[model samples]
Target: MKITSIIIALSFISACRGLNMTRLRPYDLTAELMFIFEDIDQNGIMTVFEFETVFDRYDSNVDGRVTRSVYTTYICKSDPVQYELSHYLFDEYDVDGDHFLDYHDYDNFYNKMDTSADGLVVKTEFVNYWVLLFQKYENSDIHPMSTLCR
Candidate 1:
């Protein structure tokens, strides 16, 4: 069936090594963000290990969670420095509405990336999420995600 072929192709792509981000057509900004965060080894892959590494770095309290302060700091450091830049990025990632980005929020983000519900996000799933995000931006005039992506 066509579904089977798609699955096989996705698996093959995920299994392949390294990601040439610059070569991704249409310029995927979400993938660029993930590449900055989840590609710890810089091998063009977003494994759980890499994901955790980035999160742990942001979890500055050493409490295994990320607070708004920490998340904002990370974004400010990565993104172009701007007035209240960290505030906007922190607001975006604070999913619990608790005014903080905790382990639960982190889990939610990873869950979003784990499209197959397999508790792990392969390269395909990671890129797919970025693609979807990119599309959402393309369809809208607002540039909130654009600021984050940039």
Candidate 2:
């Protein structure tokens, strides 16, 4: 099943590429990116607390963990392309390879985005990291079907 899903996703990605629609609109992607920085305190930066809230929103089962199945299910409801992309993102975030994202996983991702090591992730840092990932996946020859947007 997994392999079949991957093949289907690859086919979709390839079709999108052929149509020159491999990249999501910059404005749309940017807005979706900023949506992650939901500054509950109205601060200019995203603190760990604010970041965790975003994770919690995705923890549909309230099990204090976000599994690939749960994450993909939620994202798939909104966009099929994003549904496929979520698989890659979930793997990237699952640093411990435990197949589930817990607080530790979330914290690790937060620290990575907090490049300045100031305990907060500024919008610029967040945007730059995602842009880098998008470019990395977009140009990767080893994983032609992998892309951050489509």
Candidate 3:
């Protein structure tokens, strides 16, 4: 579930100075979160606050908590190519390595998709996820779901 590309990018940082690493791009919020996410390694260090009451704030279903089906449904309904993403998600989200996707599996998947340093997937991150869900889509002219994604 770690965006392998981004994780590898983190590993390549040559700078280890205190708060002044070469990876620190002054205009790059994404890099900063990557640093914290790498440090936590469990997604705990970057989590910013407590918002358990805000259902679908992260978990869109308002089902009290996020589950795999809810998230996958979101992805499927939004991905530019729905069919392809269904299989892609199945491959990535089966966290037990058992090939069965579930809530626990999705916990890891959802966290990885939360690209922001804020620890929560606000609308913007959802859009980012869609764009990333199919990197090839970036070249297409599809209009992203602005109201939904962000």
* Local distance difference test, candidate 2: 0.71
* Alpha-carbon RMSD, candidate 3: 15.8
Off by over 4 Å in 2: 1-13, 16-23, 27-37, 78-81, 139-150
How would you encode candidate 1's per-residue C-alpha lDDT over 6-112 as one tens digit per residue? 99999777544222232334545546665666676767656666677777888776877676655665665764332133454455557878876776676777788
Indicate which candidate wins on TM-score: 2
lDDT of 3 by residue, 1-150 (tens): 569977876755522211222222232354344334333334433232322221233367444444545545665565423422343445666667664544566566658757664556554454455445455332333232212221
TM-score ranking, high to low: 2, 1, 3
| Superposed Cα deviation of residue 121, candidate 3 (Å) | 0.7
Off by over 4 Å in 3: 1-81, 136-150
In candidate 2, position 43 carries an lDDT of 60
Question: What is the total number of backbone clashes in candidate 2?
Answer: 0
Question: How close is every model to the real structure, measured as TM-score?
Answer: 0.57, 0.72, 0.36
Per-prediction tally of clashes: 0, 0, 1
Candidate 1 accuracy as lDDT: 0.60
Please give the CA lDDT of all the candidate structures. Answer: 0.60, 0.71, 0.44
lDDT sort, best first: 2, 1, 3
Residue lDDT tens for model 2, 86-127: 666788889999999998999999899889999988777787
Top candidate when judged by lDDT against the true structure: 2
Error of 2 at 136 (Å): 1.9
